[model samples]
Target: MTNGFCSDDFAPVKEAFDRNFKELGEVGASVCLTVDGDTKVDLWGGIADPKTGDLWEEDTASIVFSCTKAATALCAHILIDRGALDPAQRVAHYWPEFAKNGKENTTVQMMLNHESAVPAFRDPVRPGGFLDWDYMVARIEDEDAWWEPGTRNGYHMVNFGWTVGELVRRVSGRSLGQFFADEVAGPTGADFWIGVPDNFAKPLAPILPYAAKPGDELSEFSATLLAEPQSLQALSFLNHGGWNMNDPAAHRAEIGGAGGIANARGQVAWYTALATNDGRLVSPEYLATMTRVSVATSRDATLLVPSRFASGFMKSMDNRAHRQGNQASAIIGDSAFGHVGAGGSIGFADPECGLAFSYTMNQMGQGILLNERGQSLIDAAYKVLGFANNRSGAWCR
Candidate 1:
């Protein structure tokens, strides 16, 4: 049974949340939805640790992987809104070291929108070395541009934390984590963290990796990508010092693009702030720049599929974001924007509907984007919002 409140208007959302555990093999998860600044549904259930049989408590939080990127982007946007940083300025204007190796022309907007062509490291990064921020920044500084600046676009993956994060640090005179906490999380009272602190660390749930069954067969697309050790797809993910969600050292470090630890409540709250144009956080004009489609295409050099992105956020464009035969953007309403974690966790805001929703889980799913587990919950949410018949499946717009 789910363990949180669900208002009468969102009863259908609770039904779908329960179905995730019964039918989708959900180990533990939470779904939170806030509309017009008030929470409509907040629920969490199942075992947080199967080994110890620990219940997933109301306070439990976990690593939301790429979902962290949206929060990181917010830090930059906050600076932009404050007139402390300019998006069109070259990144080299803030960090001269970045000007080397044909990247002198790369703009802050290009980096924010994933069009800067910064992907993987030329030299192999050591395991756990991702915790060393200075070393990682040095590596990024010396690396050559993977593609001509602003010409081709690829997901920055592990590099985004340093590429854009360092720029935030230089311009703001604060680490990305400090800037986010001081400006976004603290002011808004959201339980999200780019760098997990000592007090919050205990509530962090460990992630369990998904393993394919013996009968599963790799798609030709998947087989070919894995077969090449040097493919851009392979390099972008594998080149990172291997990731371990439970590593305390890693959690304590602020890897802005990913490595964010948060719960469904925190995720929903952050987006609600965005949806309402909480002027204290983001101005409406700049928020438009954030939500507008900055890049839209079918094939990402790193992801090998159609991907849509705004400035530091994912746009719900087409089915190219599908995962495990499910529309990853299924929950996406027209013009709605948010980011999903590496696993099934998702968080997005629909301005037109004044809706902010988030789903987070410890059980990793095979889907690269939205899994069946997340999609089902999304479908139910939109149904209650009176958009059940929307063509985008779960979209409310």
Candidate 2:
């Protein structure tokens, strides 16, 4: 059921990918890894649509959830590199209306680091409000801060799109989707899209929700969602304006926080550029700054897990020992920085090893972070790279 090219040096990754289907319950998925700007592994298999029994193809793309945040953050960094945006500057400097609701002191870096405290809507979200960019931006403008800005960090959940994305739009004079397409994807030849076009012709795979088994345990975040209906954790994920993720209109909307659509190849291609510093994305010096840890909290307000972030990207977060059974962790190299989707999808660039890696899947996984199916593939890739262990939370050579 699996098909793709794999160099002999990286055959273990192929083994893990195939094992995911045979033993780990992977429905439809693709994984790509590149080292030194060269493709080393590209694999895809299983059913794209279980209902239709359509097999996944090489070009099949699906919504990657929060992985889209990395792309949106990249757009902001591009503007920063061009001197059109400043992280230390007040967000109101770019978007004046954002100064309302005690947010005048919030800086761009605060928003990027999830410390702006406007994590989610406390009031009921209007039906289909997420599909409208202006409505969401206005919601952010009027919403009160959950805590003092820049004091504590919380996972922005869905609002990262408008919070950070608005700065990109105002400074770049282009929408986040348009800026990424023209500046990043188009030049890099990546097949990813923020707002999928109406004429998009690629084989699109609809995400299949995770089916809970009899003995499945819940994480702190999951437990909160069920126990507290009106909590920030609940509002951030459940107050989504009743928009169906499978709807074509949802796919067409530029929900930069979670609406990205791409396959493994497309994600790896984009990361490869960032990893190799090919002079197309950002300068090497700036890229180094972008990948370093910007903020870390022992307990995230929304996710309810230990988390670390670099600007808008996620740094290596290992919660394996934080919780007993249902804990989830993403253990990449110390130099790696990227984002993980709601399910298990992930894309990252490890500049230390000159590596770019991505895993895309149709079947949603249970945990808030990388699940076993995705973590196994990452572990195998690191082993092939001669990493000794991840016992220290992150893979080390």
Candidate 3:
């Protein structure tokens, strides 16, 4: 633990750790803790690469996938708290063309709640589209909802960061990356970034093995729209394997459904402000609203998952997030809320413990949620805090 903060009893998680580590070919990972705003368990492990024999030391970074949306949402909330944006307002209010179709009624609330149904691009992502904010939003505006807006839920998957980011840019006069950097990350001094800049590119861990080679009977997006389904073909129109190091757009340049990147310390720092009254990047009231489940029983049509989503953050038990229980339930606190990446990476805060936890791995895992190893560390944190099951109702009391 750093500076006398109590280290969590994390060793118990070492056994299945290999299974988790091997899946993603994870090179490095770190976990940071803040109890009542104190640092603890600032731990790191793994390697920078298998060939170079470099140890996964402190300061390594990895792409965090969907977790970045929480940070992006936080940035939007800052504007809301200051009276610049309204979750209740329609998207067309900010970008008039967004009213092109039935979306004329889509609200910021629907956007955050993932109920507006513009989950993927109506048109495929093409060269220059990643950098062209106008092109993306126009598709969102004209795109027909896979399911009627607000009638049900669907994980926006890749579209959320960009949709919300575009909303942010239209309202704040800055791209989501620029606004997040200048205000949220910059002010909090958090290491997280939506689009990683070139200067920090040197430390990025390569996506291990990348997407696993597809199965011969690939359950590719079905040929016809099944129940509430958009042709799975839309995904190709979205990211289409654009997250590689050779990709020129810089991972942050386009907020993929799965591409926010950061280390553990920054993750902890970002949430500590809200949980422990530390005030790093957001106002306490904004944090409260963001954390509270705004739509409790919503089920996502896009992902065909049940979800409990707030404006932008996700509730752990909901199917709405494709990566639910695997990561969300492994952590502590019913009041706890945050996002996890495609692999074992987790970044969440438990207000009752005054705790914030973030973990990222360079390796990738197809598992929808936290693996046994990641869960073990989560269990350890709870054990250290004096809760055996951690899920027992007593801790919050």
RMSD of each: 1.9, 0.9, 4.5
Predicted candidate 1 versus true structure: per-residue lDDT over 289-339, tens digit per residue: 777888877667676556788888888745533433453343477667888
Best by TM-score: 2
C-alpha lDDT of all candidate models, in order: 0.82, 0.92, 0.65
* Clashing pairs counted in every model: 1, 0, 21
Pick out the ten consecutive residues of candidate 2 with the lowest summed lDDT: 320-329
> Per-residue alpha-carbon lDDT of model 2 for 178-228, expressed as tens digits?
999999999899999999888999998999988888997777788889999
lDDT of 1 at 219: 38
Q: How big is the positional error of residue 311 in model 3, measured in Å on the Cα after superposition?
A: 1.3
Top model by lDDT, which number? 2
- Using lDDT as the measure, name the better of candidate 1 and candidate 2: 2
Q: Report the CA-based lDDT of candidate 2 relative to the real structure.
A: 0.92
Instruction: Rank all candidate structures by their TM-score, best first, as comma-separated numbers.
Output: 2, 1, 3
Deviation of model 3 at 370, angstroms: 2.6
